[model samples]
Target: MPLPLHHLRAGIIGTGFIAPVHIEALKRLGVQVTAISGSTKGTQALAEQWGTPEVYGDYDYQSLINSPNVDVVHITSPNRVHVEQSLAALAAGKHVVCEKPLGMTTEETAKVVAAAAASDRVFAVNYLCRFYPAILQMRAMVQRGELGRIIHVQGHFFQDWLLKDTDYNWRVLSSEGGKLRAVGDIGTHWIDAVSFILGARAKSVFATLETFHKTRYRPTGEVQTFTSQSDPASMVPYEVDTEDFGSVLLKFGQADHGHVSGTHANCAISQVAAGWKCSLYVGIYGTKGSVQWEFQQPNEIQAGYRDQPNQVLTRNTAGFDKDVANFTDNPGGHAEGFPDGHKMHYRAVYEHIASGKSTPVLYATADDGHYEVKLCEAILRSSEKQTWVGV
Candidate 1:
């Protein structure tokens, strides 16, 4: 319980696909994932596969939290369990790093924000997209007025994982995923990224949400993400309560400076474009120039100006700003993709926690996660009422 949290012991609370990513990132930061909690199906195997020293049943997550072997808890479970488990860990004086939509609703998130504020333990939210080197560069440009007078922002987070009617997952069920699927799962990332870059919060949102296939077939057996069983004989169709797609129009708060029309800037977000897989595209248009970044091109940014030729700014360019270039892990040609984003994010968290210092702006804290929930609630309200709602 002190400074220099290097070699910290971590307890992970889920064995889903996201858990492995967290494990890998923690490993890169010299953290030991000493324990894990999971369902009976694969708990042992997952522990063995990852070389975790101990395992707990899903119901025993609290026991894992109380164990002396764990110093931190990483909650990667379904939406319904995040707030409860995180509260437990905070109450136990353990630091926490929970997945996005930290709480399913604004009310739940408020409780988490309050609890974290009252405690001395570190709390982080996983909004990994912000850690990309290209994204850091974009933020620097906006901060330096390199993209003078920000005018508009637009982005989309698309995936083909649920494109087929046979796709099935807990996310489609409101009981597990909350009232929103597409917006909560992926749209938050899009919203968080642009907000982080522009240094603004969404003031209002006009939105529409839709579920293309009201029902989908679930295979009788287990299945992984992005892969679905197509056999009708073994698949059973069930009604889906959450949306598969969402589009939102957003108005942002005014920045201190560098805004074209003060609070008049707007943004649009999408999660259901066909044929696109895990694509997160964000662009900011300003009076002087414009810049765009895509997850597919994580190492480069497309920038254009009114009178000059457009340039693609790759990471680690010699003439680039030093602060932005520091985010680059290697020379210009070496690419840093999704996994690297996770690593950089965890590194920031590790550095802050290890130093026993105040939380840095570079890491997404519970407060930031709560604001994202506020925006999500407004989006849902607007979609239902067919009018703009304050965020």
Candidate 2:
């Protein structure tokens, strides 16, 4: 039995870039954000700005988790604190929704997984890209054997945010970010989304990671991601320890249900791609047919068959799976992008909590997030050793 939800009140523990996203998604589901806890510099400003009444500072995170007003906790803090914070929330008997890369390493993630198993709490990881309508359609096609034995998968997650040497963030430093930046940050999404769509897990990984800029300009003032500041005097040069780009060769094992066996694929992930911006392009090739979906073109999927011409499937159409159709918020021609994906993901989370049952569609859980951390560890090992590492 699943945990029953009432009121769906959330206590958010971080006020970083992703906090508003979580707030907006939860609001879409009519979930109340009862409290907000920010860094040491925290104030009532964020809470007031978001219309959440209660505000807690860094030291009072426990107060937020233990607050009776908060039925759930959203851990949106940095990666280093995820395990401790999530475990605390679970121990307090509160359901939790955590931001991605659930932990900095596999061991850290496993600790949370163990805690989640021992507790009767709803735990979710924000792999919101899985909620895309086209992604759901692709998964259904592969699941129903419409794609026929999936032989290969290919994709890349590219963004130009860190293309310039002036780009800097907490993500560029190893002390704050983990040793693998690009791979841990965006590569996890590519790996998770591809594995989810294909219904397969990576068995082995062979990879390489590159840190292009040895030093980057760190801004003395606050700067948001993907935005650049050019004042040389206001920025200081800092050495980079994490990778900016990575490529991984993946050999996928047989699915748990014995489908998609022995498939192989490759993914190229980068934060320094010159012109591409948030282009997550994925294609799955099967013996009978092939399917392609790109994040930039979120509303449609391109399908090709051995015996017929290529076809395009759009949202809200009879040709798509019923689940896919249901996920599509607008008519056939209306396009839904990243924000919609987050909303649908939150919808699934709230619905599951409300019904006390898991749905047919996938929403990333502690276990799924743990598996991704394992994959990231393998990728890091493969990159360091220059040898294939088993996942």
Candidate 3:
């Protein structure tokens, strides 16, 4: 008999902002979060807060991977260590759900792809934005030719958390977070969601990247993501190498679904956009109609028509229920946004594992993750050369 989803235990490998989100979602799914690993200062506290039994502090993820209590490994660590930890977990016969970008570059992520392919274990990349009910509904419409022949897509993923020069995170440094900061950190979420909805991959890219702050101040000691530094006197200055903003144009290949072929897309990615906390807005236009949705308002999608009346489709309601019934739990009026996206994503992944891999793969796979990294590399190259670059 296949194991129950709740019986398959999870081990988390980071204690940053995203790590707790993973823990909360897993707990909501009734999965046993048995182990937590990260810096010694906060690992135990996080474990205690979540009621996880095993704690591997001082970044000792190898020990956590080898733990008998852990059946699945969730790599939420910094970008630099994702490949190393993922490779280790796969070797130890554990399923993996890694945070996106997969690795710093395509070269390292390719190794992970090979490792995941060689093993029977399930490997997923945390492109959780795909689980949003509105996204799924849009995808179903596109596949069913409800959107008609695809024309183009335009959107922007903007955030203001890192807007100021004193706003510092490890992600601001190229050496720490890889080359593309705004694009890699949050823009990939937008790109992956678009690909998932359109049922296609970006074939080539033309991009322009800029660093608004050539030099920024950082605290002498490390700070967790989204946390503020109190003392300006204790700050030190460093040169910023990663981009603060990017504009990218993409040409996507044909989807097996007859309605979508050779779609054009453009996206503006930025970390310096003031007043927008975390807004990912996407508008898909086609020959028949158009659909628009934003991350800030996740519960509904606006469907536009040329001659007929436009419609506001709400989650769990008519026109939206059929496509995303399995992913959403709340009733029509109740709001489910960011946290719920993570919950639904883990639910899909966990159900697949519990069913002996019989469930359809809605989650992003190792190859999908690797392709996103390749896209990032292409974006960087295109920005440098000021021309189109194939992914």
- Distance (Å) between predicted and true CA of 204, model 3? 0.7
Q: How well is each residue in 1-391 modelled by candidate 3, as lDDT tens digits?
A: 3235788899999998899999999998889999999998789999889888999999999999999999999999989999999999999999999998799999999999999999999999999999999999999999999989999999999998888888999999888899999999999999999999999999999999999999889998788887766555689989999999999999999999887787999999999999999999999999999999999999999999999999999999888999888899999999999999999999989999988899989999999999999999999999999999999
Residues 164-228, model 2: lDDT tens digits: 88877777877666778998999989888888987888999999999999888887865655678
Worst 10 residues of 2 by lDDT: 1-10
Minimal lDDT window, size 10, model 3:
1-10
TM-score of each: 0.94, 0.95, 0.98
The per-prediction tally of clashing pairs is 0, 0, 0
Arranged by lDDT, best first? 3, 2, 1
lDDT of each: 0.82, 0.85, 0.94
CA lDDT for candidate 1 = 0.82
Best by TM-score: 3
- Identify the runs in model 3 with alpha carbons over 4 angstroms from their true place: 1-4
Residue ranges of candidate 2 with Cα displaced over 4 Å: 1-6, 40-43, 358-361
Task: Give per-residue lDDT, candidate 3, residue 211.
Answer: 95
How close is each model in CA RMSD to the real structure? 2.4, 2.3, 1.4
